[model samples]
Target: MWRNTELVRGLTLSLALLLAACAGAPQRSADPQQAESPRPAATQAAPPELPKSSSESPGAEPALAETPMHADGLEPSADTAANGSSPPMDFWAGLRSELQFTRCADEDTQSRHWTKRYAGYPQRFQQTIEQIAPLMQYVAAELRAADLPVDFVFLPIVESTYFPHRSRGERPAGIWQLMPQTARGYGAPMKPQYDGRLDYAQATHAAITLLTHLRVQFNDDWKLVNMAFNAGEYRVKNALKGSKGSRLPEPRGLSPITIEHYAKLRSLGCLIDQPERFNLQLPIIDDTRALASVELPEAWPIEFLAHLLVIDPQELKKLNPGLFGTHTPGFPGYRLMVPARAKDDLIAGLAPLPTAVSARWQRVALADPEQQRTLVLQSGLEWDLFTSINRQGGERVWLPTGTGVPKPVALSEPAGETYRVRQGDTLWHIAKRYRLRVQQLVDWNGLGKRALIKPGQWLRLRAPE
Candidate 1:
């Protein structure tokens, strides 16, 4: 992954210089809804002064702490205190009182606001806790070995609510909410056949590298690291300089303006503030010890592996949310994580398939204007079995398990209009823009299982049916 340390250093230095130039500069607020409102112009005015405290903001309210105790099957109440604190007059307590006393209090309303206060708590706190409790041993172990602040691990709860493949905003993606540029900058390859950012191993490695770098740059300050993570290091540096002589002694005391900027910009800072309210001790996570490695075959389905381990595919997906789909398409092989004890079972299940001896051939048609019909020859036929039928002609074709000569699948059809991919293009978005389903575009283009597309590459979008 470290292609060239010197090149990386040069890029990093350039970014740092760019950040310095932006430091203390008035930041362009990302709130598009407020675009029509009168506001300070970017070049002529300075940023407004930081607010004194959370209370000074127009709708500011104090946070609360409550017991983390769970009730078997009953509706959640504030009475239980996991932290052993007496019911105090905190925001949580008040909310709990409202919940208990109000006649209209319901599970839906409570669930929606539960995460609003606590960053890492599950959205369906009761259900999620029950589900995650069994995996705590595994999660805690990883947390301990990583020596990372426990709260940071829970950040995913805020990012994807433990749901893998969740998409938000304009192309922000995966559990970590990484954008394409940032994800690529961190070593995720944007290629025609693979997106390393969605691969858990690759993503975890990238995340760790980024976190470590941020920690070093910010002098091991977790809050600043978190802020830099959300708003970009440049924005954080600018916020720091804007605070200047007024900078807080530490992150806990950072002014509301800085905290609000981070929260509003990235939608995470307020969530991170939860542990502080409850006085819960953040655990140190050790990633190495918690993750047990299992080798996977080329193009192995991760969902199948999760099933083999008898673990929730969603949970597995959560742990490794960077993968684009159920399978890892190509590259230096893949690794699947399992419980430490299930290593033997996984290994046995993945024993390589016997090699094929006889030659094989298949014919398929292209739906595009080319209406191309192709004849292909191969010793094994796994590609035709796994990939969709509509794909027939392309620069790249999926091959079977064992390597062999790939004879072109001959096509008989007329050529169609070609379209070039542009920046910010996605199969779904592109199909919609051109009035097609994700599958239609894939079939028309003869894309492989990997479905890798790149900017500037020409694709054949068929004429309307």
Candidate 2:
């Protein structure tokens, strides 16, 4: 007790000295009598103040506010809640909502390969979608119109990355990645002059048509249809033949490639369906910038038409990718794609455009051959434009836009009852033959606005006037 008392006394003295040192001694006057006067207790120093928080002042640095965690935390959302309608109906959401296979299967029981890691696939796909927004949105709208699963819209990601000009192994081309045979089967021409496989509108029609047919063949099994699309119907059938098919209700066959293909699709579908899982955000896209297809029979210069319509020629080419040159090769159903906004103005001012583009001009040599060919040229060149133009290889050929093109032409019309359609016959040719307007010919024939006249379809030469 005596030692404790001694320790407490020592601590007391030390603390008092420390306080005095911290408080600091006040200024000692030059005269000691002034310092002898007692300073008030309030004048003794207090503790230093702390810096102000950001919340208290505008100039202070701020800290992130923490979200308060409850005893019960937030939960993942259910697909269908009280209303049981659906998730959001946007493009990605629509695709996700249609997925029949949601539960991840055990590796031992399932054939799906989760091998392809999520390494930049989502980012690449989002970039590609942005690059081809108009075309993709158009495809999605068509799919919705057909009352089919919109999941097929993502097929182009697997096929060609939405690039219209992509080709593989010297044969397949376009956004759909259709082979020459498949393209022909769907009535898209793949000739040297004009490969219709690259045409966005036409290819979308063909893809949907092909999908419809595949759906029938595979009994509406989209997985099998997708496999058929990727590996061809023959291989898919063979795969189904060997194994009891599981992707569909009916027993289907499976192959390694087909399994891998579907696995890739499923993987791609997941990334698109839930991009947040991969830390990616997709751009909102629409095909609302409307494109109108204008059927013109003559070989018109793309540049001239673009200038007249006030559209960029490069952009116009994107809309009409089938035409493989500066000037359209006058196929029978040559549709020129123009901006829907400018369609009315172009139609109003089309007087500057030539009446005919194909087999409509004949070569005329002048004294000044280069300067005077356009002065006195002739229309009604032979129906066999390929041979006629090739024969005039050495002559200066005047174009519909009054420019000179130094190249040959393409295929001829067939002889049959009321003009059998040839490989490259445009409606203008048949109309001109019967001395009827192209619209009259189309009206009599019941052709769609953008429909192409195929090689063997007989066209009506004359109607009751």
CA deviation > 4 Å runs, candidate 1? 1-123, 132-140, 165-170, 187-202, 242-327, 332-334, 337-341, 348-465
Among these predicted structures, which one has the highest TM-score?
2
Best by lDDT: 2
1-465: candidate 1 lDDT, tens digit per residue: 011000000000000000000111122234311111111100111112221221233123212111111111111123332422342334233222322111122223332243353333332232333222323334333444566544444443333222223222324344354455555666554443345555445544455556667777788776677656654565455456534467545444333333432232122222223434434333222222244645453555454556455566655644453443445443444445555656776666445432231111122333553323232233233443424422434643323322223332222123224555644345643443233456767787888756678867777767445
The per-residue C-alpha lDDT of model 1 at residue 22 equals 10
Judged by whole-model lDDT over C-alpha atoms, candidate 2 comes out at 0.46
TM-score quality measure for candidate 2? 0.50
- lDDT, model 1: 0.38
